[model samples]
Target: MRKIPKPTLIAKDVFLECISTVGNLLLKQNYEKCQDLVEAAAQDFDNKFPLLEIYQIPRNLTVLGSIGKEEMKSVYTYRMVKDGMPGNTFYNTLKNSAPYGKCPLCSVRFVETLDHYLPKSLYPILSVVPVNLIPSCSSCNTGKKISFPTNSIEQTFHPYYDDIQDESWIKATLLPYDPFGFNYFVECPDSWEQIKKDRANNHFSSFKLNTLFTAHANEEFRGAKDHMKTLFNLHPDELIKHLDGAFRSRRDQLGINSWQAVMYYCLLKDNWFVQGGVLTF
Candidate 1:
């Protein structure tokens, strides 16, 4: 997963805006008790979220609308937190924070929507909290919908907090066949703690990243067939050097474990592949 910069929009400001909008709506609906409860919820939210202990808190249905928790969740999910006037501005800011408008969660698809790091349904108070919102693609958002970690070890890597790109963790192995294929896997450093390794594997599996990368690698290999043939004509020693250069280039452009870098590096290391394995295709 890619590390995303923290959003510039202040969380308190966004929370206040949401409260104001929702408060006005509640007043119009003649739910003064609910409006007062919302104010209390706002204070509780600030303590939980801004203080960074939100995960420990449980969903309090009592503070929600008089209509009930389900209705309150719907109002926040659809109206107040996602589609309302302030929400539009909030969503845009989070989306713009993504580098090159790409989803930070997978570093693949374009940023299409904001995902609640903590699902808004479970933590309605955090529905509009800037720190709780993440810019994401539809796939990542849907795959991760409403799933929160039960423990610290189970927590998926947060782009705002985790930056695993500094190391090479993802790896691939070539399948020598006519239509050469690859398999991607998480191979975390031996120095990493067991918890980190588990989390990395969890992130990869949860997003089905291995399947996605394998498909991409196959497509990339198809396009590089002619180039590989041309490189094979060069001295085998030079071919290794060229492949290493390509690996480095991809690593520099993307991260160390980017699919291209991993693919090229693995190919360069495989004696059969560097010599004549690719020619079979």
Candidate 2:
């Protein structure tokens, strides 16, 4: 996953801005009463985030008198998401936080919306909290759904907190097939703790990223298939140099672990693929 710089928006400011637009007097009054609770939840998030202690945060805080979970969620869906609303600016900011508008969750798809890291349906108090929101594509967001963590290890990578961009853990292998198939996986270093490796593996597995990457990787190969065959016929050594350049370009433009980067790495590493195997496609 790509590392995203966290949004600078403050929770109290966003919470107040969102609640200010409520025309309903009763709802506004109830929301006014929960300012401290919302701020506390944000603080709890800030304190626990680095420690993977999200599962310990208070939940279903029935403290928003006359304001149930659904109402609190509307503060985001109705107020913040609507154009020209007070909270809309912050909403857009969070959604655009991903570098180059790519979803940090998968680093594959373009970011389409903001996802609640701690889903607002379950943790209403964090509905507007900047740290709790993540920029993600629709696919990644749908893959996540409203699933919440029950333990530290269950928590997926938080792009802002967990920077895996420089950490090249994704590995792709070119398998024998009519044309070919890619097998993608996460391989952490031996120095990492078992829990950390398991968490990474869980994140990779739960998202079905291997399948996602495989599809994209194959499509990429399809486009390059003819060029590779032509290059090998021109000169096999030239094909090696060309594949090396492709690997370098992808590694430089995208991060090392990107599907394209790993795909090129696999192609360059396998001499048979570069010299003759690619002709199958």
Per-candidate Cα lDDT values, in order, are: 0.72, 0.84
Model 1 whole-model lDDT (C-alpha atoms): 0.72
- TM-score per candidate, chains pooled: 0.83, 0.95
Query: What would the per-residue lDDT of candidate 2 be over residues 51-97, giving only the tens digit for each residue?
Result: 98888886784656677688888888888888989999988988877
- Candidate 2 stretches with Cα past 4 Å from truth are none
Instruction: Residues 1-79, candidate 1: write the lDDT tens digits.
Output: 7888766566555544544555567543633345445545545644554333546767655444454556556544554
Q: Cα deviation of 35 in candidate 1 (Å)?
A: 10
Indicate the TM-score of model 2. 0.95
- The residue pairs in collision within model 1 are none
Alpha-carbon RMSD, each predicted model: 3.7, 1.6
Q: What is the RMSD, in Å, between candidate 2 and the native fold over all Cα?
A: 1.6
